[model samples]
Every structure is written in C-alpha cells, then in structure tokens.
Target: MCLISFYLIFVFSMTLFIFGIYFILYDYSLFIEWEVVSMNSLSIVMTLLFDWMSFIFMSFVLMISSLVIYYSKEYMFHDYKINRFIMLVLMFVGSMMLLIISPNLISILLGWDGLGLISYCLVIYFQNVKSYNAGMLTVLSNRIGDVALLLSIAWMLNYGSWNYIFYLEFMKNYSEMMIVGVLILMASLTKSAQIPFSSWLPAAMAAPTPVSALVHSSTLVTAGVYLMIRFNLLLYNSWLSSLLLILSSLTMFMSGLGANYEFDLKKIIALSTLSQLGLMMSILSIGYSKLAFFHLLTHALFKALLFMCAGAIIHNMNNNQDIRLMGSLSLLMPLTSTCFNVANLALCGMPFLAGFYSKDLILESVLFSYVNFFTFLLFFLSTGLTVCYSFRLVFYSMTGEFNFSPLNLLNNESWIMLSSMLSLLYLSIIFGSILNWLIFSSPILILLPIYLKLFTLFVCFLGGLMGYMISNVSIYFYNKSLHYYNLSSFFGLMWFMPYISTYGVINNYLMMGQLSFKLFDQGWSEYFGGQNLYFLMKYNSQLNQVLQNNNLKIYLLSFVFIVVILFMFL
Candidate 1:
C-alpha cells in the first residue's frame, strides 16, 4: 500500500513539476471558477488557480510527501496503526495541495483548516501524554491563525467577492483593505510559527518523524508564507509589512539561539525550521515575495531530507533522540550519516548546495534593501546561529566517541528508509540551483561592497567553528551549563516560549474558567437556579401540609379571630 501510494504521488509530482515549468516559461495561468450561487448581486464561486507558483509549490509538496510516505513504511513497520498514519499523512498532503491551488479566501480557509485538523491528528498519532500535549499546543496555536483567516473572509465580504486576487491591486488604494491585510498577516504569522506562536513548532516534534518532515518542511508551516506570497500586493508597503519584518526577525534570532541549547534531535531541526521560516517571513515582509518563495522551495527540499535522516538515526538508536547520547554514528551508519551531513551542510548554506543559492540571494537582498541596523544584525547573527546549530548537530551526533551502551548495535541497513532519503538527497544538493534559474527570468543584480559580500561566508565559517568548540566544551566538562543556570535555561527553553504559549497565554483564561465554574456553574447558578428553587418549593409545600392538617379546630379559631378583627374595625 505504501509503495503504491508512493508511486502514484511521485508520478503526480513529476507531472505537476513539468506543468509548472511550462506555465512559468510561457507566463501562463489557468483559473477555473464554478459559480455556486448568484443572489442579489452577490455571487459565490469556487476557484482554483494554476500558475507557476502554485504548480511548483504543489509539486514540491507532493514530492516530499511521497518520499515521506515511502520512508514511513520502514519507520513505522513495527507499529500496529501504520495504515492510519499513512492515511493521515495523505490527508495532510491533500490539505496542502488544496491550500496551494486556491486563490479565493473561502477555498483557502477550507485547505487551511484541513491542514490544522489533519496535523493535530498526526501529532497525536502515538497516543501518548506528550503527543497529546503537543497536539493540543499545535492545534490551539494554529486556531489563532484559523480565526484570523475567518476574520479576513468576513472583512473581504464587504468588497463583494471572496476572491482576493481581484482585490489585491485595488486594496492599497483604500484604507479599509489595510485591516484585511493585517488579518492575513496575523493568520500567516501563526501558521508559520512566528514570534509568540513558535513554541508549537518544536513541541510538535512529539509527532512521528515522517510527519515532522512533511509538516515542518512544507505543508503546515509553509502555508503561512505561501499565503503571504499570494497576498503580497495587499501587504506590500503597508504597515503590516514592517510589523511582519520585526516579528519575523525576532523569531529567527530566538529560534536560532534556542536550537544551540537544545539536545533533542528532532526539536533542534524543528527550531532550525522555525528559524528558516522567520527568514522566509522576513524576506516576504520586505517586498521580496519571489525571493521568499525561492527560499521556501529550497528550504522544503533540504529540511525534509534533514528530518528523514534524523528519523533514521532515531530508529536505529532504539528510539532515543537526545543528541548528547549519540556519537561516532558515521562509522556504523555511513550512508545515513553521509546523507545527514549533506543535509546539514545544505542547511548551513554551504557553497554550491541547495540552501546556498536561496540563502545567499536572500542575504544579498537584505543587504541591498535599506533597513535599520537592528534588522541587519538579527539577520546575520541568525545566519551564523543556523550554521552553529547545524555544525553542533553534526559534531555531536555524527563524530566524536560513541556515547551509547557498547552492547547496542547500530547500522544503516534499512534499505527502505535509505532509498527514500537517497531520492531526496540529490534534490537537496541541486534543487536550489535549479529553482534559482527557473524562478528568475534574468539575474538579480545585488550590488554590495566586497566586505559585505564576504560577510555571509565569514559568518558560516565562524558559526561552524563555534559549534565545534561548544560541543567540545560541553563534552569535556561536567554540567557546564550549571554555572550559567538561568541564562542556559532561558536559551534552552526557547525563551520560555512554551511556558508563555501554554502556561502564560492560558493561565488567565484557565483561571477565569475555573472561577466561572465555581461562581456560575457550581455555586451561583446551582444555588439561585436549581437548588434554591427546589428548597423554596419544599418549604411552601411543608406549610401547605401543616395548614391542611389543622382540620376543624383551626377552622373554628380562624372564624373567631375574623369576627374580633371585624368588631375592632367597626
């Protein structure tokens, strides 16, 4: 079943890829619209947009999803619910495809909600407490974006059409459209896991690794960036763009710093995904939607590869994920390690690799754009931090002495998994160059000083060195972080983002819920509503029973008292 799914999806991916290329070459776009209803000058239509961007993105999504499905056959072979997992993954891919093709806000909402729902199911696939918590965080965080999209839909209703593509050009002329743009920005920020919504991206690592690779790399997280790209005109030159730039830069910086202190292999990669997402968002915020899209495509290729390699390692290590306990894996699992290293270097934007093309272009563009020093510093520092964590990951998990028990045997003999990874491996190597050439009709002119041009390369080298040194220091010393306990905890704990997202954001609301339960549901409502009415009725019934039991004697006394009262009145 998995193989059949893989073959079908792979074929579809290739077909879409070819179609995407043709569309781009010819600058052609196909829009299919079906009018569902027309009433009182209001027409409801379902729309699908097939253009170079949507086709290419859809193709990449399907390709990665196919490889992941193939990889999961081995990764989840021992599990009883493997079929369920495969179905959920396929559903996720479907949601992403729907999102990619839809230009209308309503149709986009359908796909957006589908991604959230399916992602929740996949995250909790393991049915453990951790998985459950992670799933909750992931869903609730994404729900914010869902609400934003819904609001945008409602706001766009005033414009007489749910099709946003028609309005993007004219929206900038009217100030009311700025609200729609802001709503879209909020939705994108949450979906992409930007600042204040980032904790879920890493916590979602509780999901199966294949899900991680697909969700983090392309489907769920990238949905935001994709949305922003579609609405680039709405956001371009708006205050929302500047806001997005600041938040995304902080997101990038925070995640990069957090990844360095993280030991969980999947979480580290997840943070890296967060960092890269911030990069995409930042670039998009600065009017380089195409550049952001370029980075997004290239990022998907290598990040998916990175996650698969991590999955393979975790599978061999008997489900252990702590990088601290892994070392010298290259000796035993040569092929997997090689693929892992390639993916890592590609992530660092190593020369001639997939990441280098997009990342290099993005940095140059940032330098070319007139921006504040703060944004510039965050960009370069985050770039270095990315290299730092990548190298740290390689050094700790792939090199040095073996840290596992001597009796444990590890090997990269899982042909099914390795083959799936190998499929993506070459793409991670060359996809950037291919995408760069295809996306741009002509070369982008980036004019920068010699020093500025070399800056990115210098940061990569320095970050790699720092990563190596940090790993060595930690290995040699016992509890080195204990000295800077508070500082370490802050960086390691994602700047308390999980706490803020879960405990911080929910604490007041939870307290209010509890209070409401006590004051209304349990206390006031119970007393004044059901219990109080019941007691009052009981008392009246008791008095009636006593009056009824008084009989003839009480009747005689009542008559005498009435006569006396009449005489006094007279």
Candidate 2:
C-alpha cells in the first residue's frame, strides 16, 4: 500500500535524524542516525546551500511526523473515513518534510503552500457548516499571506541575486531593504496570525478534535515561526525588526485575552497557540534564534499533547462542549486527569518541564537583549498574559465541579488517547534539562541564569493562580473601571474636529465659515464655474457621492469589506 511505503520512508527519515527531537524531548536518541544528503543534487540557478539551521528544522519535522503518525494510528483507528484521514495526515507529513529539507527558498515555498492546502481540506472534511466556514476563512486569510509571499519573491527576483547565498549577499547591499523586509515580514505575520491578519485562526477551531490537536496546534501553525527563523538574516538587518518586535508583543496580549474569553474546548487551545507564536516572534525579534526555535520545538510537543487530551475530554463529556456543564474530571478519569494536569502544567510553564526551559530561555534572551526599556516592558507583559490565559482554559475544563456527564463515556476512556497524551507530557517535562546541549555551546553563559529561570517558573504558576481567580468573575467587570466612558458620546466625537479643521487650513481649504475650495485662480473659466461645469455635470456627481459610489463599489466587492461591514462592524 502507498500508505505503508510513506510510513516506512518516514520511519527511515526519523531513524536518520534520531538526535533531532528526541534530544529535546526525552533524550531518546536511540532512533536517529545521521548522514548528509548529497550536496550536489540537481541544482537550481541560485547558490544552493545547506546549513545547521536547515538541518535542525528538518529533524524537528521528522520527529513531529513520527508523533503525528502515532496519534493518527490510534485516533482514527476505526472510523469509516479512516483512510481519508490517514492520507491527509501523511500528505501533511510529507509537506513538512519537504519544507524543512529544501535548500532553496522556492523549494521551501512548495511545502509551505502544500501544508496550507492540506490543512484547509482536513478542516473542512467533516462537511459540517462550522467546518466549512473554518476552511473558507482559512483559505481567505492564507491568500492574503500568499500575496505577500509573491511580492517577496518579486522583490528578490527584481533586485537580488537569484541564488540563496547571493540573495543574502544582495540584501546586504540594498538601500531599499525596507521594501524587501516589509514583504517578507508581512508574509510571516499573516501566516503566524500576528494582528490585523489573525482572525482566521480562531475561526479554524471548527475542525475535528484530532486535526485540531495535531495540525492546528503543533504542526501547521508552527510553519510561520519556522519561516521567521529560517530567514533570520533579513530580520537581523532590517529596520522592520523593531516593528516585528512590537507587533509580536501586541499579538501576544490580544490573543491571550481572546483565549480567556473563549468557551469551546478546541478554541481555548487555538487562541493559546496564536499567543504562543506571538511569544516566539518576540523571541526572534530579540535576536534569540535558537531560543525561539527551541520554544517552537518545545511547544509543538506539549501542545500536541494538550490538544489530544482536550480531544479525549470532549469525547468523555458525551459531546458536551461547555466547561460550565462538565466538572470533576480529575476524579472521573484519573489517567486523563493525570495527562491533563501534566500537559497543562507544561503549558503553564511549570518548572523543569519542557515548557519551562524554552520559556525561561526566551525571557532571559529578551531581558538581556540591547533593545530599549519599553520593548522589554511589552515583552514582559506579553509573557504574563500568556500564563494568565493558558491555565484559565485548563482550570475551567478539567478541574471544576461536575454538572453533567455523557452517557456513552460515563466511564469510558481509551488507552490510545491516554498513551498519546502521556508521551507528550513526558517530553515536555524533560526537554529543556537535557536536549539543549547543542544549542548551548558555552556552559558558563547558560549557568548565570539559574535564578532567573526559577523566577519565571514562579511567575508562570502565579499567573495560573491569578487566571483561576479571574475565571469566576465576569470578564467585563474584571477589565471595567470605576466608571466607563463612551467614545461615541458628544464630547469625544467632536473633540478631534477642531484640530483636523486647523490642519486643513494649510492645504488652502477655507473653513472660515463655508466648506468651499478656491484654487489659486489659474486661468480656468473661473468666473463661469471653473473649466466646464456643463461638461463636469456629465461625468461627475458631488465629491461624496462620487467617492461613496467609487470607493463603496470597490470596498463592497472585497472579502475584508464584506466581513467588516456585515460581520465585524455589524
């Protein structure tokens, strides 16, 4: 069978890269054996190259693919549509493999788009109205990202050397690096769900539990972070690096807030991931490439575990989704309880877990970076927000009082689900302590930060405690002040009109008493109404009407316009 062949090839790849993920997670390196792919493969025109970064990323993909299989095998075991799920997942795995292994940026893009297309199909496969909406939204948002990527390629092709190495060299010489920088940054921003481009990911929570668990949380969303790291040189040199930093911080805070307000089991994790990627971006912004990559690698492991555990939770609740109706899962399902607690603790970034190491590393790198105080503050605040929402989801779902129970799973729990979650929990616990040997070439530099690492652990737990307390209180009240002011009120609405009118004076527009424009009477048939009033009447309406129709038509036809007018604004 084709499935068997792909699985065997995948196993072989994992066996070859044994040291990649195992070292980070369990220090289980028994599987990986390394060999260099021939450097002289059929070459594209650009200078082809291989580097340590590419090697590490490929290895991470291999590990994730292996685990995804482990998950798919048990998760989709008996469903009538099992074959379809298996094929889709395998396709996802192959895309990830090609992405990480590719030496050329063009080649990298093949896997990037491949992963996105496959995810869209998987999300929509259930054919439910919710699933269909999620898939369409996913497609819409990712296309905004594709436009950015195509522009990035255009910039490179127009100005830089066509080869990867020469491209980097070419970038070093360009005065308009800002143009190239913005395009690349935009692509990654949309892909990573960082602000203004972020609405699609939350909507994507409509997919099945397993797909949500594996693809959305751990694998697919991580592609953007991988891209950022893969092209760090662009970030390191460009003026937009600081912009990336600030955007990342804002995204972290915003998504964290969303996750707190979410009720759906899958959505809680989905929002959590968007915030996690924000943290990763901020990490990259601070010049900590390896640190950010480690967090990505670390997050994929624990998040996958958490998503699977959430899947099991949904199954046990008799399809009851609201945390309000289900409670006391800790006692009801001990194994699920244990796995949930472990993964949640890891997600909470508890000490000594896989989450703790990468997180502390990111914070330490941020604290120590030469960036200014305000940047540090935003970074710190985002960190606090991530912890706040992560455990809010955990406590609400698995820890409270039971109000209802599902009939079929009143006491049912599957071994496959338990083992899959347990594997992730184990990896998150020990990943940081052992697997970072290659990343930390200097023992002494890593040693000075022991106290700071412990502090982050404490802060992580404290954030979780605060989240638990805030959960019972209404969110509106938690954020509400002693008194709230309405922005649309008379004073607030009129407050800015005078300033704008004053500025309009510089443009030679008379606001003295009348809204009229007198152009310096160039020899127009001015006395007879400018150049040709009768002729103008044939082609034009009032400015507002002309604009309203012209702009309105263009705007109305846009996806963003339709969504904004009908959905967001309404």
Candidate 3:
C-alpha cells in the first residue's frame, strides 16, 4: 500500500512539474486567493502567487522530492515504520510546496512552522538518542526562524496588513519596516544554517539518507534563500546588506574548511551543502537575488544527486561512512561512482556543468561588484576552498586503495534507486544550460581583464593541486602531518561548532535553571511558604491551647493588663 501511494504521489508531482514548465514557457503568472478571515481593520487571506520564480522553484522541488520518495522505497524497506516515513516525507513536500506558493506572511508562517515541526519528526524517525538530540537541535534552530518571522509579522502590523508583498516597495521609508527587514534577514540566516546556526545542518545528517537528500540538500535549507529572494527589494540599505554579506561569506569559508577535515560521508556532504547555502545567501545579500535564485535551483539538482550517490555507497558499505575507509570504489560501483564524480565536478564549477553556470557567474559578479576587501577575500578564498574539499573527497573515496573487506558490492539490486539517480544525472548534465537560457534573457556583461575573468578557474586549479598533493603527502607521511595536529583537529571538529552551538549556547540557560530551582523553589519558597508557615501556625495553636486551658481568668487578666498599659502611655 505504501509503495502504491508513493508511486501515485510521484505521478502527481510529475504532472504538476510539467504544468509548471508550461507556465514558464508561456511566461504566465497565476494568483488564486481565498478569504480565510475578515474583521474590521484586520483580514487574513490565503494567497498563492505563481510566477516564473515560484513555478521554476516548485517544479524543481517536486522533481527532486518525487525522486527522493521513489528512491526511499527500497532504501527504507526493511524499517517497520516505512509507511510513517513516507507520510512524513509527503508532509514535508507539502509544506515546501506551501512555502513556495505563499506570498502572504500569515500563510508563509503556516508553511514555515510546518517545515520546522515536520522536520523534527523526520529527524527523530530512527528513534535513537542521537536522533533525539539532533532533532532537538534542528527544531530549535529552525524555531529561531519562526520566532523571527513572528516578530516580523508583529512589526508588519504597523503597516496595516499581513500581506508583505504590498508593502515591500515603501519598506525603506519606515525605520520600523527596515528593522523588520533585518529581522527577516536574521530569520533567513538561521534557516539557511549560516554561521552560528551551522551546527544543526551537519547534525541533521542523523536523518536517513533520503531525508537528507531531500531536506538538507534542496528543500528545507534553501527555504531561507527563497524567502530572501522574495524580500530582495527591502535590502537596499548598505549596512544591512554588508552585514549579511560578511556573515554569509564567513559561513561559506567555515563550512568549506570543516569539510576538508571531515571524514563522515554524510557530514562532508552536509558541510558542502552548508557552503553552497552560504554562497546562495551571500549572493542574495549583495542585491543579485535572481542570480542567487539561479544558483539555488541548480545547486538543488547536483546536491540531491550527490546525497543519493552517497546513500548508494553507504548502502553498499554496510553503513560505514568514514571516507578513509573507502577507496577505489569507481572500480566496484561504477554507476554510483560516476554519479558522485559528476556531482563533485559540478560542485567544483567545472566548465559547462550545473555549478559552472551559476558558481562561475557568482564569482564574476563578485569580481565586478564594489565589495570591501574582507568580503572580496572571503569570497575567493571560499571558492577555492570549495574545490579543495571536493577534490579531497574524490581522492579519499574514489582514488585510493580499497580498504574494505572483500564483499560483492553490486549496483544492480535496486533498479528503482538507480533509475532515480539516472534521471537526476541527466538533469545534472543539462539543467544548468536550460536554466541559464530561461532565467537570463540577456547576458550579464563582465568588465574584467582576461586574467581576472579566469580568476576562478585559476583558483580552482590551485585548490585541486593543494587538495591532492597535501592529502597524498599526509597519507604517505603521517608523522610529518601530525605536527599540525592542532590545526587539523580544530578544522576536523568543525571549529567545535557542534559543541558550541549545542552545549555552549544551552549550558548557561541550564545552569541558571538549576540555580533557580535551588535558590527559590527549594530554599526560599519552600521555607517561607511551606515550612515557615507550618511552624508559625503550630506556635499559634500552642498559644491558643495554653489560653484555652487558663480559661476566662487568664483572658480577663490579659485584657486588664493591656488596658493599664494603654492608660499609662496616654
């Protein structure tokens, strides 16, 4: 029954994708709204705005999710709760669709909250302690975005409407509205896993591979980029834009560095996803949201394929994810290896591939733009680091000695999974050219010298050299490399992001909670409200008992004494 349901959903999604393509071809826009609530001076409506942007984005999302769902049928077949997994995945897809179409903040919140809550459910689907921890982090990080959105909605109240689309034009005129823009940018940073929130993304690899392929690669993490694209008009301020650019560039560099030292197969890929997200967000911040959107869509294609390939390799290797334990796999699993290599090359911005179209363009734009020295340095350095880590990944996993025990790693057991990958593989080949043509009617003119125009390529070559030569030398001369243990350990552990974002942020609050329990609940409140009150009542009762025993004589004596004292004072 689950299989049939998934198949039906895939068919429906493909149908929607085809229609979305047709809409794009005709350059058509669609708006369908229904009144959800109405009152004096306040109203709520469900509005879906489907233009080229939403259509293209939704079509790509549906395509990738349908492939992921199909691939998961076999990937998760042994689990007892396969149906539940399918349901959660379906819910996630629906939430992404809701987010994509929503133009109003009210409806967007509904979708955004759904993504956060459903992602938590899916993250913990394995029902282990690690999944529980990872789920908590994922939900909490995304909750920051939710809170920011709520604040933005409250601030938007000053504008007299919940429909942000209507007020985006004049947002700069109002100081409060500009603050709302900053809040929204902060919201995007959290969702996109930029910098401090970066821990949740690599941690979210605790989810099953299919979920990672869909959520981390394309849908959930990219939601922030999509949101910022929607709000691009509000980011005209230089200070806010510069702040965004700095944070996002640092995120990119940070993740790229982390990936170089990472050994876990899923985590390396997750960090790369983080780096790409930083790329998208950084570009979005610099006022070329369309180019950011272009990269967002293309990155989704290759990254999903990358995750799927990693899943295939892990499935064959009995769930072993350490890259050091993997080698010479191209000779064993040719199809998956090919896909992985293709995805890696695309990620490195090899000419004419999906990433080349967008990534190269991004670098070119950065070169032409009048950015500060720090931003410029971070961009190029991170771009080179991207190639460095990708090459490191290929060398460790595909080019070295086969370290696994003898086992028949067949690639033909699950034709469904293979077919899904193949479908995406075809897209990874051609989608970049297709999007490039559809998105930009005219080419962006570059005014750089030839060498400057080729700067990214030169950087890519140098990075590839550094990755191959340095990693190879380290393997051959382990003792020599050990001299840099401090640097290696720091980068390997993601600059201790997992610890800081988890323990560093929570430890203070948890300690304060314990202190409050001890100081107030147990000590002061318990003594005054419970123990002290009991003692006072008991003392009064004893006094009353003594007075009762003495009867009317003692009461009369006490009253006469009190009257005599009052008279003497007068």
What residue pairs are clashing in model 3? none
Alpha-carbon RMSD, each predicted model: 4.2, 15.3, 4.4
For model 2, the stretches where C-alpha displacement exceeds 4 angstroms are: 1-10, 19-52, 159-161, 406-408, 444-455, 472-570
C-alpha-based local distance difference test score of model 1: 0.91
Clashes of 3: 0
lDDT per model vs. reference: 0.91, 0.67, 0.86
What TM-score, over all chains together, does every model reach?
A: 0.92, 0.75, 0.90
- lDDT by residue (tens digit), candidate 2, 189-268: 87787876676776777776767766755467777787777677777766667888888887777676656655677777
Model 3 misplaced stretches (Cα beyond 4 Å): 1-28, 38-43, 407-413, 479-481, 526-570
The runs of at least 3 residues in candidate 1 whose Cα sits more than 4 Å from the true structure, single-residue gaps closed, are 37-43, 478-480, 529-570
Instruction: Give the 10-residue window scoring lowest on summed lDDT in candidate 2.
Output: 489-498
Residues 1-570, candidate 3: write the lDDT tens digits.
456765676677667667667776787988898887899966667888978788778778877887888898888889987888888888898898898888888788888898999999988988899999999999988888899999999988887777788788889667656888888888898889997788999889999999999997668999998999999988776478878888899899999988887789999999999999999989888889989999998899899999999999998888899888888888878888898899999999999999899999999998888788889888988888889989988998888788876674645437888988988888998999888987887776778999998899999999998889867976666545468888888887778887887898877778999999898888978899888989999999998888879588888989999999999999
- Return whichever of 1 and 2 wins on TM-score: 1
